[model samples]
Target: MLEKVTGLSDLKEILHDKEDEEIVFTNGCFDILHVGHVRYLQEAKAKGDLLVVGINSDESVRQLKGKKRPIVPEMERAEMLAALEMIDYVIIFTELTAKNIISELKPDIYVKGGDYKVNELPEAEVVAEYEGRIELVKEVRGASTTNIVAEISKRY
Candidate 1:
């Protein structure tokens, strides 16, 4: 049922039809797709009728995160996140942040992992413009892509 990774424009159109439903937006690199990512997505979904995950494009990942980052490619990362039942749609954005997408969709709720301060987020202002509230889900400490990479390096 429309389960696949899509572009921002297409997602905006699709979301237009479901304007009445509460849309929750969250953005991340999700390079390794760890437990923390899964839990965060699940919690985000719980906050609204639909969960839209904005994944940083490969180029954007390299820009936001550094080289040697995003061990998994953007398409693969988006595909993995879209596979999760908790995520209603996966939008691969080219920007370092999902501010443009947020401005266009103006989701009812914006969720982030506990690591971030709501007011500190650059998108906070965009969300605020639409009166959207930001929610932080409890993070699974020590369960990060960096930690996974470190462990892999230690093993091999």
Candidate 2:
């Protein structure tokens, strides 16, 4: 499972041989794993032969979610995602958005939670440039790390 966690260059090398497969790509901070994440990933995986997840690096997560965010560290987060049965590959990225990763990977399909609009995504252009399909998985209502954190805080 840990072996599933890899760097971009190495992932590219590995993916190079998988040209015959329909690659599915998705990215997020994944600060704290939850049921919503599991279902989202499973849905993403069903879109293609392989599911590659780009995780936000610790610094990137901080930039996006504020300093006290990312309840889990980057490596731990990557490992957690890699451990998932539906996830074929997991890579940590320092970018705030998935545009660079999407540009480089150019996956057959790009998946995101339905919470985001396709037109609002920065990586949507890159996906379109490569003629890749964009999929939006319906999010599980009331199932999010932010909500979990708030509930924990309120109880504590």
Please name the candidate that would achieve the greatest lDDT relative to the true structure: 2
What is the C-alpha local distance difference test score of each model?
0.90, 0.94
TM-score of each: 0.96, 0.98
User: For residues 1-156, could you state the per-residue lDDT of candidate 2 as single tens digits?
Assistant: 999998889999999999999999999989899999999999999999999999999999889889998899999999989989999999999989999999999999999999999999899999999899999999899999899999999999
Off by over 4 Å in 1: none
The candidate 2 region of ten consecutive residues with least summed lDDT is 61-70
What tens-digit string does per-residue lDDT give for candidate 1 at 40-139? 8989999999999999989998988799987999888888888888888988889888899899989999999999998789999999998999999998
Residue pairs with colliding backbones in model 1 are none
Candidate 2, superposed: residue stretches over 4 Å from native: none
